[model samples]
Target: MGCATGIVKYLVFIANLLFALAGLALVIIGILIKFNVSDATRVLPSDFGLAPILCIIIGAIVFITAFLGCCGAVRESTCMLTTYAIILLTIFIVQVAIGVYAFLQIKDQNSFYSALKTNMEKTFDQMDRNPEANETMHVIERVLKCCGVTGPEDYQTPKVPLSCCRNIEVQCPSPNNDVNSDGCAIKLQGEIEKNSKIIGGVAIGIAVIEVLGAIVALCLASSIRNSYRRHTYA
Candidate 1:
């Protein structure tokens, strides 16, 4: 029994240590993504912009929970272990719910694409009148290596925006041969799809880890309780 409890204790400690690292990783990833996608966030749905903030919040919670679990394991406290188990389970459920919500939101590719196109068109049309819009469009185009919503033809004038040029430093030729041929909508959609897969993969991985940690915590708590009862009765 002592051997088994010792193994479980060490396991819990290791698991919580991993949890701490994962939490820190999440915070860093969230901050990086927030900055990296700042420009694209302007054109995306408002809810989409909240993703990084959510990550940071979740990460902080996980880090705190991990600390609790580590303390409980090292001290062999049944109460703390049980509390840690409950928190882990709660976090697991919430993560699953959020994942489902995100999946459903993006399931309808057609609607998402249509909405993106509409937003891009609106932003493009307002470029001349809205300085912010103009700057945003230019940044999007330059970074994404894309042209107007559909193509250079979307522009009323024969010459495309300087941002559409493959090389911003050089002058944009009249023939527009040096411009990117891809549409911003298509490029943006592709980027979202690619990033969504990565996010989904990470979420699934974290969920698995949470479930395992919760199970281990509950088991350890039960063992501690049983040992205490045995000692008391003996």
Candidate 2:
């Protein structure tokens, strides 16, 4: 029994250490995505824009929960182990929910694309009169390295925005060779789809890990409680 308990204790500790590292990786990924998408978020749907923040929050929770599990394992505290298990179970449920949401969003990519295209078109049309729209479009075009909603042709003017140029150093709105012929709508949709897939995959994977962690925590807690009971009776 002692040897079994010792093995379980070390297993719990090692599992939690891995969990902590995973949590930190998640936080870093979230931050990178947040910064990478900051310019595009201006036109993105509210739910899509919130994904990075959700990732950050979940990562923080996972880190704290893993820390608790590590301490509990080292101290052989049944109370802490039980608490950790409950928290892990809760996180697991939340991660599954997020994963499902992300996949559903991916499944409805056509509708998502349509909505985004419409939004961008509206923004482009209003750019002449709306200062905010103009600024947003400029940032989107420059960062995305694309032209108008559909392409430079979408601009009725003979000279498109300088941002449409593949090389701003050269004379823009000139030959096709100097311009970015791709459409912003397509580029933006591709980015969103890629992000959704990533979020779904990562969330599902972590949820599986969380379930295993919860099971291990519960088993460890049970073992510790039984050990205590045996010592008292002896």
Candidate 3:
């Protein structure tokens, strides 16, 4: 009986660990979603465009894992808990890989945005002369202006990188930000921060709670298995 309880405890431990890991992952993703790309020198990445959606989905999964882990840990079931723990570990590793890849992607996006901005600046005048270039430049400049930079400023300072456009206070996606203030700049910085910070930070937290839950499960499983072995041998 004592051994059995120990085994069960091991299983519970594994589950708890997995769940904690999952929860951590969720918060990380939530953080990422809130982060702003303009200041980060990164535009919305093409490949990572779906990252926010994926984080939300993963966060839900982590929350569910927490619940399951809590249940298994309380029940002290070795085999079941062990299975959960193993699964959580696997997911955790995968999440780490995804995080690394995402960071790399952000770097790549930053570089790309810089290059694109430079090229755009160089060709802005030509755009007016060429119909296609005109349309493209008009659209691109509009986005830049909306994002907070003065298009004319770029002409004065050609040495500045793409990020120079970021300082201009314009209408961001945040609800509270009023684009029509004095210079079409954003207001309510707190609101802006909350919404922007969710992107990169949240993306890093996938499967965190699940890892914690797995740890809890491991404890429960160990306890249960030990107990079973002791009784069966006796």
Candidate 4:
């Protein structure tokens, strides 16, 4: 069983190393995409339905896996190590699935635009009804002013919606629509949202998994590399 255990450990080690690489790559890409989004550059379609919060969460997971892999390396317990590798890989698979879902969700651009128009009409209707709601319309106009866009599907126009204006320092418009524009901004908003979500998100997710896998593999390659170092180095 020592030979079998060693083999398992080696396999687990290889897996972990791959995952580590993948995770680190993912972390970098995720950070980049996140930064771009912060600049108010819409990269993903709004209809993708994945929130920016979700992107951060995934990036955070890739980073967390880094610590987990390191812990396994120091522990020298193949069982504990393999557990981490599996999780890293699992998340990569899940991320791929999310990408597919996002693609399908936004594929029908016309439908998405229709939804945006309907929502805009609904919001303006409420705004028109109440005297106090007048400010909401101007708020929306401001978003149009900033984004330099007009109308729901008006991506070519030169006016950003006023509603997109916000006090938040990060990501001008929250992934959540409650804070931003009424129609013009919100309607075209989702277009860049999904790409932003998947580009770094999927990239990092895959990279993290691959790196951890490689790391684990390397750990097994040098099975006895640290047998003595474990005690003396400690």
lDDT of each: 0.86, 0.82, 0.51, 0.52
Q: Give residue 93's lDDT in candidate 4 (0 to 100).
A: 78
lDDT of 4 by residue, 60-154 (tens): 67657655666665566555456555665677678778767756655666665565555444445555476433454454445443322333333
lDDT of 3 by residue, 16-130 (tens): 5665676678767755764733222222224434656666676676666555666666665565667667877877888778767755644464464544454444445464476
Candidate of highest TM-score = 1
The TM-score of predicted model 2 comes to 0.79
lDDT over C-alpha atoms for residue 50 of model 4: 39
RMSD in Å for all candidates: 2.7, 3.3, 10.2, 10.9
Better of 2 and 3 by TM-score: 2
Clash count, predicted structure 4: 68
Candidate 1, which segments miss by more than 4 Å at Cα?
28-39, 129-132
- TM-scores for all candidates? 0.85, 0.79, 0.48, 0.47
Q: What local lDDT score does residue 46 receive in model 1, on the 0 to 100 scale?
A: 67
TM-score-wise, the better of 1 and 2 is: 1
Q: What tens digits encode model 2's per-residue C-alpha lDDT throughout 27-117?
A: 9888998987565565766576786887788778888989999999999998999999999888777767766766776678788778788
lDDT of 1 by residue, 73-154 (tens): 9999989999998998999899899889888877778888888888888888888898878888888899899988888778
Model 4 TM-score on a 0 to 1 scale: 0.47
Local error of candidate 3 at 34, Å? 12
lDDT measured at residue 26 in model 4 versus the true structure, 0 to 100: 59
Model 4 regions lying over 4 Å from their true place:
1-53, 56-60, 128-234
